[model samples]
Target: MLNQDVLRNARSPGRGFAAAKRGFDIAVALLALPAVLGVAAVLLLLNPIANRGPLFFVQARMGRNCKRFTIVKFRTMSAGQPEGGPAPRGPDDPVEDERITPLGRMLRRARIDELPQFFNVLSGDMSVIGPRPDVWDHAIHYLDSVPGYRARHTLRPGITGLAQVRGGYAEGIRATVQKTREDLAYIDGLSPRMELYILLRTVQVVFTGKGAR
Candidate 1:
């Protein structure tokens, strides 16, 4: 059974919180623009030799209200893996996939691959902090398999979020359920204080390479 508190907290926020969150997203995105761009520029120079694929990997992700949006990340996989290989086994599974280049491993470990999503945040497709978006395929599978899974889509997806920091990559239906709980908890407890906490944790995750895949 669902916890009433979780359900209550997961409800869409009032207009004030929504507005404040948007303001915060804009402020943080703007503040981080220089660094994000700098890294992207550096990666552009290095990636051709390092990874030997397109500079950016663009894929459709389920965003707020389950809308589809294209998310950008540095291409971390080798060029031309045949489509329709087995579904990704888990979130962290990609870290071990043979297609990942050595340099891609380093970038994933440093969380540098995700820097491109700052553009998504700036474009209003995402926030600096919230539930991370899922690829459309995973989103569809989980929507059917995981109860209350759709709840996480009520707000804009985040570049980093409670699930990424706390649970890392969810590997299966059970793990995805746990991640949903964390995400709902975050929504229930949304505030400047919590936002700040997630931001600090994100920095720690990035630097320590605690949960990158």
Candidate 2:
């Protein structure tokens, strides 16, 4: 039988952990805010000529326990499109190649598109470490296709994590499942030390421009 009680107990420590992580996030975000905001402002200024309209975009995403929250990102596509043309997919999705704007492509390559998520972290809708969030549409789709997909939601979503550093955009169900395993592995070993390791690796990867679209 499924040990719901054990799983429930597993999260009893989360409230304390969440408080600690929030403090850490606030400290880091405050330290990085000047730089982060500068970069985002520069990008917004350039976007008019590059991508055009809407400095930031928000979409409904699923978070812990399948709760809904709006995710923020730099707009990387033209504002106008045919109704129901195509939904935003993962970075690796073939459709992404078609819908992304020229300047949007560059934003994604440099990960500038994700800059707005810092606010999400500060707001406690996300974290600096954990599995990435998915749009509710994608979440629904994955729940049907991938085993234990919801397990990743045991904690808040993150801007960077084992999955992002390992395999940027899930290639397919197999890849997604693999990423889920990594997320679960992280959950099993969650700690400040382990999170520091993941964060360090994430910084290394970002600087080196590795495993990014």
Question: Evaluated with TM-score, which candidate comes out highest?
Answer: 1
How do the residues 59-85 of candidate 2 rate in per-residue lDDT, one tens digit apiece?
A: 877798878898888778777652111
What are the Cα lDDT values of the candidates?
0.80, 0.73
TM-score of each: 0.89, 0.84
In the range 141-196, model 1's lDDT, one tens digit per residue, is 88877777788888899999988998786665677788888888888888778888
Candidate 1 lDDT (Cα, 0 to 1):
0.80
Check candidate 1 and list the clashing pairs: none
RMSD of each: 2.7, 3.9
For model 2, the local distance difference test gives 0.73
For lDDT, the strongest prediction is 1
Model 1 residue runs over 4 Å out of place are 1-4, 82-96
Q: What's each prediction's clash count?
A: 0, 0
* Runs of candidate 2 exceeding 4 Å displacement: 1-15, 81-93
Model 2 TM-score relative to the real fold: 0.84
